[model samples]
Target chain A: MVHKALKIARVMLSVYYAYMVEYRAELVFWVLSGTFPLILMGLWVEAAQGDRFDLTPTELVQYFLAVFLVRQFTVVWVIWEFEREVVEGRLSSYLLQPVDPAWRHFFSHVSERFARLPFAFLLVGLFLLLYPYAAWLPRLDNLLLGLLATVLAFCLRFLMQYTFALAAFWIERASALEQFWFLPYTFLSGMVAPLALFPDAVRAAVLWTPFPYLIYFPASLLINRPDHVAQGFAAMVLWSALFWGLNRWLWRQGLRQYSGMGA
Target chain B: MERYLKVLRLFWGTAIAAELEYRLNFIITALISLGGLVGSLFGLFLFYRTGYQFAGWSWEEALLVLGLFTVLQGFSTTLLIPNLNKIVTQVQQGTLDFVLLKPISSQFWLSTRVISPWGLPDVLFGLVMIGYSGDRLGLTWADYGLALLPLTFGAITLYSLWFMLGATSIWFVKIYNVTEVLRGLLEAGRFPIAAYPAAYRVFFTFVVPVAFLTTVPAQTMLHQGGRGWLLASGLLAIVLALLANRFWRFALRFYTSASS
Candidate 1:
């Protein structure tokens, strides 16, 4: 059974990767669109040059570079995809398929990430070349941990957004809800700034929430701050399980509701 | 001119009434707009907490720039983006033929066919922010008066840029990603252009010209940009409008009817 599932996953990944390559322009745009972190990096680096923040300019650069890298991995678009399918009645086709619809979304997103990886690497390489001052030597252990944390972070974000997308079952405005969720996520996820730069009260409050575990904790690992690694992993696992439960509940309810509506 | 006004009134009246049918969307959009405003302000607050001026602009000045950015963003969302999106879809679905068949200029009709009244809350919120920031700066009435000229030109420039992008759908049916690219670039306008590095400053000013969208207007209001800059902005708007119009015509020539 496990072997069959692995074979299916392999075929799905290859198919989606081939399909994703057709939109090379869009793939490039997606990579460029994720450069907001670099913009914030520029601002913080300039400020740090004035010795205002406790962070040195080089530290600010490394932190935001890590942020840019982590952001590329943690991106999610399943909310939009699910919303479109549900609204347009395309979900019916997926419902009839033998495989779960969510797996298709997962495979497609993973493949797109693979397609986007080279562009992201090229951009990062160019950025580092242009700003060599931003270079840093991360410890090998921390680097490995950062990669692990990043994988977990990506899974957490994707599942969370997929759960949010399930709201489409009840409302036509699920995307709006997604936007509402996005606002807080932007601040809490350390996309705007390192959570450490936030006031102590805000940082403490955010750490308790699952948002920081999605981006900040992983990013902090790369910067050699592993003090919270164990706790971060614990929060990640707890939140993932909770979201997984919520997703199953919502999917069952939504499917019933959808079929009742004659879809 | 009177005929265009009548047509616009009729178009907006029906469009708004059609949108009102989705009552829940109104509340959702209002909340989303509010969320966006709060998110931008929170970002500014974080920078302010650092207690250092960004690009020589204090927190108050930076807030004004953000307000102007929000106002222009609200305008684009309210009047421009939805219409452009509709045109792109029409082009894709071969429904643009009906638009071209209309007696009115297709450009004008396509540009004015939709107005999202639900976006008004963002405009109101942005105006309130601008007023508050202006009060803090103690701007004279004349400063506000001068700011209006550049703001009008900026709106024209942005509209032309969007129209040009929409027109390109004639050739590239899936130009939605280009629109997304523009949206991403516009995010930079939330801060003063000076806050960016020299390379980015040049790119945003001359290449994309997002600086005119917000930064110049805010600077003009604060008595920062001299009249020379204002004149240059006006010239750029006219030049861009003409260039966009020409590009639209050029694309139209290549547009073999999607239906056929």
Candidate 2:
């Protein structure tokens, strides 16, 4: 049984990777669209040139670069995909499969990261090339931890969005919820500015939410700003487990609701 | 011109009626715009709370720029997004053939086909912000009037650029994300151009022309940078508008109507 499941996962990932590779041009555009962090990097780096901010210019550059990478890795579009599946009655086809429909999206997103890896790295490389001084290799343990946190971040974000997507079982425009959710994620997630720059109260409040671990925490880890590393991982795990439970319950309830509609 | 006006009325009338079915979406979008506005203020506050200003811009002046940016963003949501984003879909599905067969110009038809009223909340909030900030700055009617001239031109420039990018879908069928890139870059306009580094200022001014979108209008409003910037913005708008029309025609030449 274990061997069969592993084979299934392999085939799913390979197939999705091939499909994603076919859209190399679109992937490139997507990578470019994620350049919001780089844009903010310019402003923050400029501000850091002064004496007001907590981080120096180089540290700000590295932090935002790490943000750009974390953003690329944890980008989730499963909400949109899942909404479409539920809306167009396409979920019926997936319901016929033995494996959960969620895994298909999971594998597809995972494979897209790999397919998009080169373009993302190329952008980072170009940025570093333009400003060679901003480049710095992360310590080995920090790099490893950052990678692990990034993976966890992806899983957490995916689970959260997928749970929201399950609302499409009842609502026609469930993606609107994700849109509303994204505002807080964009502002509080430390994508716009580092938590270090945020006022003490705001940073303290934001750390309790799962937003920071999604982008800021992993990014901080990459830049060797390891503050409360254990707590950060704990919050991520706690949020993931909570979302995972809620997601499964919703899946069951949404399945019943979906079939009730004669879909 | 009369026929075009009539067609636009009909287009938007139905678009509004159809959209009204989802009345809840209005509240949702308004809440979103409100949340986004607060978040933007927070970001600006983060910069200013440290006693750092964007070079020459005072808090009120930067607020003026941000308000203009918000208005332009509303404009995009109301018109540019709903219409232009469908270009790729039309190309991919071969619906462009039908659009071409219409009695009106395809560019005009495609550009004015749909209007989403959900962006009104943003427009309202932006105007409120501008009024509040301008009041604080003790601006006269002439200042607001001068800003309007450039603001209209800025809208025209933005529409032209967006239309041209959408037109590229005739060649690359699934390139709607190219417009996403444009929107991403437009986020830079939320801050004054002077706030960025020298390279960013040049790039936003020349490469993407984001400088014309909000900064130029705000400058004209504040009576800063003289009328030279406003004149340049108008010239850029006229040229880009013409280029967008010509580019649409050029792109249409490559339309092979794959599905057809």
Candidate 3:
């Protein structure tokens, strides 16, 4: 059974990887859009130069670049695709498949990370060239830990969004939920600023939420800060499991509620 | 001119009537905007909390820029996004033929076709923030009046650039995210131009003109930076507006449409 599952996973991954590569031109623009962190890096790096903050200018540059890389890997759009599927009743086609439809999204997102990686890394390289003084390699253990955390962050983000996508089963414009969810994720996730610079109370409060682990925790680990290592992983695992449970329950209930509206 | 105004009224009237059906979406978007406002405030506060101001900008001065940015955000949502984003869909679906066949200019119809009320909350909140901060800065009504010229120019400049980018869809076809790249870069406008490093200041000013969008108008409101920056912004808007029109006409020449 395990062997069969592994084979299926391999097939889905290869298929989605090809599909993602077919739109190579659009992929470039998508990569360019993630330059939000790089822009913030400009502001933060300058701010850090004053020595009022705990972080150095180089560290600020490093942190935001890591944020940029983490963002590219963890980006999830399952809600948008799933919303269209349910609204158009195209989900009926997926319902007939033997497998759970979630794997398709999971694999597609995973494969997209591969297709997106080259451009993302190229952008990182461009950023490094722009700020060569800030360029430094991560320690081996920290590199391993950061990569692992990034993959897990992607899963947690995907699960949370897909779980929210199931709301399309009940509501017509479920993406509105995502739009609302994104506001907090954009701010609380440390994409806007390092959690270190946040007010002590705000950072402590945000740490308990899933947002920081999605970008800040993994990014901080990558930058070799090494703070909150144990707690961050635990939070990510707990959130992932919670979302996974909620997602499965929603899928079953949605199937019953779904009437194949447009199909 | 009168005909265009009549058409715009009709376009927005029907658009609002249709969108009113999705009352829940308006509330959702408003809540989201409020949350965004709080988040933006929180972000700006982080820099100030450490007693670090963006060069010469105080908290209230910076708030003016943030407020103007929010207003432009609302303007885009209400007008720019609902209309310009559909350029890609039209190009993809070959519906541009119908648009071109219309009695009116295609760009006119395409740009003014939809108006969403969802952005009103952002506009409202933006004005409130402006007023709140304008009061804190002890600015008079005349000061607010002075900023309107640059603000209008800023909005025009933004619309022109966005339209020009959207017009590129005729060739690129799947250029939806191309416009998203513009939006992402415009996130720089959330803070004053002074907040960025000198290199960033030059890039935002010359490369993207994000500095014209928010900081120039904020400077006008504060009675700082004099009239030089304001004239440059107005001139930039006029130039971009004409270029967008020319580019749209140029792009239409290549519009072979889909499935041809």
Best DockQ among the predictions, by candidate number: 3
Q: How far is candidate 2 from the true structure (C-alpha RMSD, Å)?
A: 1.1
What tens-digit string does per-residue lDDT give for candidate 1 at A49-151?
7778878888778888888889998889899999888888889988888899999999998998899999988988898997897777679999999999999
lDDT of 1 by residue, B1-260 (tens): 88889999999999999988998887888888888888888888988885777877988889888888888888988998889877789888888888889988888899999898876878888888888888998987888898899999999998899889888889878777777778788888889988877778888899989888888998899888778878889999999899987987788888877765
Interface root-mean-square deviation (Å) of every model: 1.4, 0.7, 0.8
Show model 1 residue runs off by greater than 4 Å.
Answer: A260-263
Q: Model 3, residue B1: displacement in angstroms?
A: 2.0
lDDT of 2 by residue, A148-252 (tens): 999999999999999999999889889998998899999999999999999999999999999999999999999998878999999999999999999999988
Residues B23-107, model 2: lDDT tens digits: 9999999999999999999989999998998889999999999999999999999999999999999999998899999999999
Candidate 3: residue B41 lDDT (0-100): 97
lDDT of each: 0.86, 0.93, 0.93
- Name the better of 1 and 3 by lDDT: 3
- How does model 2 fare in lDDT? 0.93
Task: State in Å the error of residue A182, model 2.
Answer: 0.5
**Candidate 1, pairs of clashing residues:** none
Q: Which runs of model 3 end up more than 4 angstroms from their true locations?
A: none
The Cα error of candidate 1 at residue B2, in Å, is 3.0
